[model samples]
Target: MKKFRKIGVAAVGVLTLTALVSGCGTANTTNSTPSSSAPVPTGNAGTTGKLEIFSWWTGVASSKALKALIHVFNEKYPHVQVINEAVAGGAGSNAHAVLASRMTNNNPPGTFQVHAGNGSLYSWVQAGDLDSLNNLYQSQGWLNKYPKSLLNLITFNGNIYAVPVDMQRANVLWYNPSIFKKYNLTPPTTFSQFFQDAKVLKAHGITPLALANHGNWETTLLFSDVLLGTVGYTDYNKLLHGQMSWNSPGVVQAANTFTKMMQYTNSDASALHWQQADQLVANGQAAMNVMGDWAQGYFKTTLNLTPGKDFGWAPTPGTQGVFSVVSDVFALPSKLSASQKAVALNFLKVLGSAEGQKVFNPLKGTFSPRLDANPSDYDAYSQAAMKSYQKDQLTLCIGQGAVNPGFTTAFENAMAIFVTNHNTKQFIQSIENAAQTNPLS
Candidate 1:
């Protein structure tokens, strides 16, 4: 087994780059341990050996999409070894624990995954744990490529920390066309209409929304969108920022509204994973699923469904229309050799490339963070999502993207409790508690 340990710098003021070990064969799995027995490895990867990377992308379709990106990365850098430390379990748990421990001990992966948002990145940047990439961003002009909403979130204090990998779109409704036809139902355009349609499906003995409650992310996704549907984006931000409490009517009403929607989900939903819920909709056993755009990758790879021809995708209706989005971005550590920094920057540039956008997002079943990137190249679901996104006027999906992960856990637990115990008031209170209690960057 490869040994791992954490190393701390003797010098307090200098920026310390986190360490990653090398020489794991191609079959390496996630061993979150940061070993002290070895020197922090570095080299001209493309001219030499592998570039070990870590991320939470162990799902079949997602892993496949990731491999495709790696293949693209290899095409131009054939000599570089790309070892994937993709781990599964705990709904990003394995990676989270490893990274948190790493950052705490001042050890970070050469490349690890993290969400780009105000509340997540600011502290790390201030601690000298992250590297600055203003020159790279200025050179590539990421401000022009990535949407202002996303770019703004990645900028902490003033510096960009991460290389955005993909845009994770929320508020998508993936429904079986055959099931819709059988029920004589059309996709809803309003909350009232959606409930009425749910009744129509339930009356005919169908689960209106296929969901998996075990992983809190799913519940949180809906929770974020519900706030949007009930209150609109501006007010949701106010509530999130502590300008208003959950007792405020909008938060309470959103919880109450979600309480109603919970009735139409599958009875066994609490036992299922998000992928299993995707399967339920795919098999036509359930009528719809409200998940991120990545859900399309599952439908494409598992059920082999073609978008539009066999199924359809749309955003949930809101009083004021907008897209709720999450993003995955990569942050580089400091003190790298000039060549290594160049390679990292080059890789980031490619990730934003038009070809990269076309190949990666479609395979990942996600949206490109780039506004000017072409959407016509993606699957039907993404195409429709992009269309709605362009027209709806974009807004941050706080529950998924803006909320701190620590608080997200709180809200998810509150949602589960609310769903099981029928406690809408407590649900509202829990969100308020998070804003007040949890550590926001």
Candidate 2:
């Protein structure tokens, strides 16, 4: 077990490159120990203060999950007040922008949401805006609760910076089961099969694929799936880490594949948000959608759909047996007052506890990062995703936390232009130029 642990840490550290990535729910106290029942892990016995919890979790399902977790926290510590300072839009883009301004003005929140991976979390550490959480982890017994590879992503200079809350698989292909059954089609496992299905659906006047790029990151997310499916995991990681060139044959092929996929997407893709695109599939207007497991939350909680009944999911074409990790984590700001820090640290304890995860992940449509989180606490989709996370090959979700921000910015720019122009050559060229300035490694 120890030998495997070392390899897991090393392998994930290389593939993940150091930060964790981004998602959930409610309380079902079955057989497991409930963290809410334990005393507050930190702060004075009568710790009474306001803790501003910040994040981009203002969506219907996510907001509900956060509320549930807060409810549990209040049960444990009635004196502490939690201020839900969530900003909406851009899949965390708008919230992050607001957070940046607050941090710059020395008005940091007590604790804030961050992607668990290196891109966002480590960058904050580099900026000296976060405090180390090693003591918190030790106190919570989290050093062994979460996977070492996951912890490795949040650890910088031997100090862990954040506590991961939930893990979301980003390479999922969600579809309306009724649409597939009516068409007598199966979910595609390969590109050729996807095109075939798309062709059939299109001929029948159905939009084959549902896409939303309002955030400018959704298109990049689609391209990432295409790139991974085309080049396979090994080269995908290489390309992400800058060991492989942007103009490599695999990337070109991926760009071409992505262009082909766009033909089957709805004409109004650019105008729709991700949820709207997902709504198309739910309404049977679109056959399928490529998105993270967070879509599962929307389908289950917001849309009131049943898993494996109204909706079905599979790995994006050619991505079977691979898990593209997108995790959401929380961290303490360095500038908090002692009282603020105490309350914040206690909140982190609840956030990292098994009881909190059980309540939060089920409602949010994500899986707990902790190894001990009960599978029965989740739905069918989450159960499958949890098994995949345990058994499959893990890769970083592109644009989430997989690469440096410089490359991510350029990649997103290239994707935005490519969607409008379908200029494959120019898209590749733009990415190549960005690689020159912002090396992925």
Best by lDDT: 2
Which run of 10 residues does model 1 get worst, by summed lDDT?
A: 19-28
RMSD of 2: 7.3
In order, what lDDT does every prediction score?
Answer: 0.66, 0.81
Error of 2 at 127 (Å): 0.8
lDDT of 1 at 351: 64
* Candidate 2 structure lDDT: 0.81
Error of 2 at 187 (Å): 0.6
Q: Model 2, poorest ten-residue lDDT window?
A: 21-30
lDDT (Cα, tens digit) per residue for candidate 2, span 1-441: 011122232233211212222100000111321111122343364368798999999989999999999999899889998899999988888888899899999999989998866477766777778887876766666666776656766766556778888999999999999999999999999999999999999999999999999978999988889889999887887776667888999889989999999999999988999999999999999999999999999999999999999999999999998788899999888887767777888888889999999999999999897777788898899999988887676677678754567777887888889999999999999998998897665
TM-score of each candidate structure, all chains considered together: 0.84, 0.90
- Candidate 2, TM-score vs. the true structure? 0.90
As a TM-score, model 1 comes out at 0.84
